[model samples]
Target: MLIPPRVPNRREDGLLHFDLLPPLSLYVHIPWCVKKCPYCDFYSHAISSAVPEERYLTALEQDLEASLPLIKGRQVSTVFIGGGTPSLLSGDAINKLLVILRNKLLLTPDVEITLEANPGTFDDDKIKAYREAGVNRLSIGIQSFNQKHLDILGRIHDVNQAKRAVEIAMTHFDNVNLDLMYALPHQTKDDLDADLTMAISYDPAHLSLYQLTIEQNTYFAFNPPDLPDEDTVADMQDMIEMMTATAGYEHYEVSAYAKPGRACRHNINYWLFGDYLGIGSGAHSKITVDGKVIRQTRFEQPPTYMLEAGKGRAVDEEFTLSHEDLGFEFMLNALRLTKGFYPEMFEERTALPLDSIRPYLKQAEKRGLLYRDPTIIRPTEKGMLFLNDLQQIFLPDE
Candidate 1:
């Protein structure tokens, strides 16, 4: 690790000081997919021809080189390769990319490296190659086992393919995460129950069950499908909680469940407001320098991002976090966890006094939206149900 020069917190000194910095992670994005789903809003482009795998890898290398200055010496605790379907890249491509990371970055010895894969894009050999390339975890996107729901969501894989993907991943990796979505158009409690049952049957190490929502630019938003009523959706949520609990899974986050010690460390770092450096097209990064926090983003389009990255200037936008921004941002993420955060972490992460947010904390507790004591600050049952309202209590006044 390349340790940066540290200075004292004294204002008189020229340099800034952070007594201790948060853990760091890395996120690599692959922006090409076989097809873009209508309801998807992430910046992923559909490839009509072969993927530009080699060019994209080179661009990622350049982006990482440019970013090393900001994170000199800090060991990356985790690396998550997410995307348009990172599985689309050939196994050799993945190997080369991981080699680049190993050569350039000071990664922790037991770094939790995860790669996101789609059923339609991988085979036994490909999955094996990823495991050989130092990827210790695999997160497979299996939206639904029901053929109708799979088609409705524009997923390329069928029921069999989804099962095969999981089987193959289980063979190659011990740590796996299966993603599923509930509250689809015209879905019912029974539909969700079936999906949950199928997912639980796999006995995956981690489960990320999300509720589908239409975003402004998504196809579902424009041509809205008939969705279940709020009450019906509520029942589905309850059923999910009950079933997963019965299956011996712990609901640690809003939409995540895991076996003992199997929670995604990468995601946990995010919810804890830890720093991460994102590389690749359309990636975003948050880093803390000295005592100030900075946010950055690369260009959204693949072509544009690749072009800029070759010049060692992939970052398109950058900004520093303000005091109010820090307070709101911290709560926005940390509050998502059912376990909440430690009070001292508020000061450690945001570099602000804990007393700063005490009034807002009191307000949330008064409204029965939060419960805080010396040991920890967590959400109550009501707070979890109305999480948006609870998080809003800490928002900076406009």
Candidate 2:
């Protein structure tokens, strides 16, 4: 049971200085889904009648209470309740959770609260209830509108249902994001185009278009489906970006698009290396206290998390970041943005000198994996394709 030690505080220029403390966000994981998608790799379990929603909510509140000491006085500006279909919970249950968050955390009036909703689970009443519970944003999982693609992806909703879900979401929430997947097995360009057009027709404020990937432990992994060729996948990506841009959406991140001023702030916080607290089963968090970055995780199993509620012993482990590790992490996330971070942000966030990362920047620039202007460090087209290689350049020497 060894734990990583926290870094010692140091002084700079006769003034006490610690690592930069970024703004905090909160992530709540809902681990239950109606049915697992074959290509999914997230930590979600199939739903049963024995979900124990009331008890789970109680455990979540207690979990927040125990973590209060660490997050005291920090104002939470964003909260994303993501999952195996967080919309499965009744509106009352959702409201109860929000009530607990408001009571325990410093929730700003304009905080962006996003709940992940599966199309099949959302109804008009549930949508209105969720809106009433203070959820301002909805990210609906509408993977594809093609019936064949839907079946292949194991989505419960049909094309019409998916369209209806978006209409319902827009009616209830001002900001709505549609999640779509492309490059499925035997999927044609026409199929991809139709899905994108259907998604756009709904006039969602944001879009998250992801490429389907086969992951380990999924049914697809054991008997992998014949996926689209690499060239075809690339074509799909190109077409999606073109269509989305033509429709006036900004391709902010690789997979995300947004209307003006509608980018997901919580995800931006993550890409910018801000602090966040992760609550619920199998959640992970990184927080900054007095300049030390503290990383922690909660129990992964539902029963274990419930059993350890209020004891503060639900955490599997806690550790602090090393200086070198922090730099790599900061850049790893920051570089993902098409518009890379400002030069001064590195120093402000990592408490490290600008010169510390010069060598990596020079190497990456030479390889055309990154673009460096006088003020910003952004990834080039080549860099985005080989992101892992670009990130490896920042890793600490062994």
Candidate 3:
């Protein structure tokens, strides 16, 4: 029932033009967390003083209002409010924010609205308030249930707090996603098994299982923890696939799993190379318009973003994607799916013929990393295991 915006012409001035615009999603970022995790690197600042909720919300509204003209007439299919812990805001704040979005944007009747919550930051009433605010879905950041692992990861919530958060989320929302990470420092197979068992016990609609990795500029990178070796991590992944399959979860994406018909639709739009407008401090956006694909970003700092937004221009950077950029970027996202994508989808999203990636396809196939017939293109098992290498094959230089 999703209706896409249509373009009258196919091409303009030798530039790419979409006959039908890809499905669009909306992302709102809240840039404050009670405390930053040691291994985290997302654009989030720890709260030293009381959050300027009213000022920040005003900035978000202004930011969205100014960007509406670019996405005029397009129906938004999904909305995901992510963060530095968006749950830090009060339920009334969330209500006001969604009301503004609803008033300004053309959201579908059944738009899947999601807000990310962290343990220790929300109670049952807050969770209930979020649900009442038209947020139909909740994604909780319950990184681990093990006390030792939780401490090692420097998470703000304790084991009991994690369980309480999930219990509360399940009480209010039917569609919920739990974010868990495995392959932690000094974590054992039994430890992971216990965590997975605890997560499945709730029968949540979806689960996002991730392998912990130390990223540059994070505390963990400077003082690296004693993580399990590569082979052990591989075994842990295999164990996750088997366990989740037994629990009726589908391994849809590399780091995402879900029950039947419960996949994260907003994220799926991303994997399909669809367009999304991201608003807030340090948020990024991919938009298709004027016969071209453009990328945009807002200022990273909260104060700077609010000041810029008040001036009716919150975006700090913008650039159009080249043909090479299109081909590589499309595959970069599409190939993450287990079922991969169809040639028709590639053409629709990238506005480029499948012929553009023929050489890269052949190269990947030659290395036994890809599978393609006339109708579909997918990554083989080996390809999924070595996903980074497979995605790198389609790089512009390659």
Query: What TM-score, over all chains together, does every model reach?
Result: 0.96, 0.94, 0.96
lDDT of 2 by residue, 281-390 (tens): 88899987765678998888888888887575668889988776877899889988888889988777777766777778888999999998878889999998788899
Across 1-398, the per-residue lDDT of candidate 1 in tens digits comes to: 11221222324543334568999999999998999998899879899898888899999999999999999999999999998889999999999999999999999999999999999987999999999999999999999989999999999999999999999999999999999998998787888988889888889999999899889898898999888899998999899889999999999999999999999999999999999999999999999996688999999999999999999999999998876668779888998899999998977887676676777888999999999999899999899899999998888766
How high is the lDDT of residue 268 in model 2? 95
RMSD of 3: 4.4
Off by over 4 Å in 2: 1-16
Which of the predicted structures, 2 or 3, would earn the higher lDDT when compared with the native?
3
Per-residue CA lDDT of candidate 3, range 1-398, in tens?
11222323346575776778999999999999988898999999999788898999999999999999889999999999999989999999999999999999999999999999999797999999999999999999998999999999888899999999999999999999999999999999889999999999999999999899889999999999999988889889989999999999999999999999999999999999999999999999999998889999999999999999999989999999887778889999999999898889988998887777788898899999999998889999999999999999888763
Q: Please list the C-alpha lDDT of all candidates, in the order they appear.
A: 0.90, 0.86, 0.92
Model 3 ranges off by over 4 Å? 1-12
Task: Pick the TM-score winner.
Answer: 3
How accurate locally is residue 338 in candidate 2, as Cα lDDT from 0 to 100?
85
TM-score of 2: 0.94
In candidate 3, where is summed lDDT lowest over 10 consecutive residues? 1-10
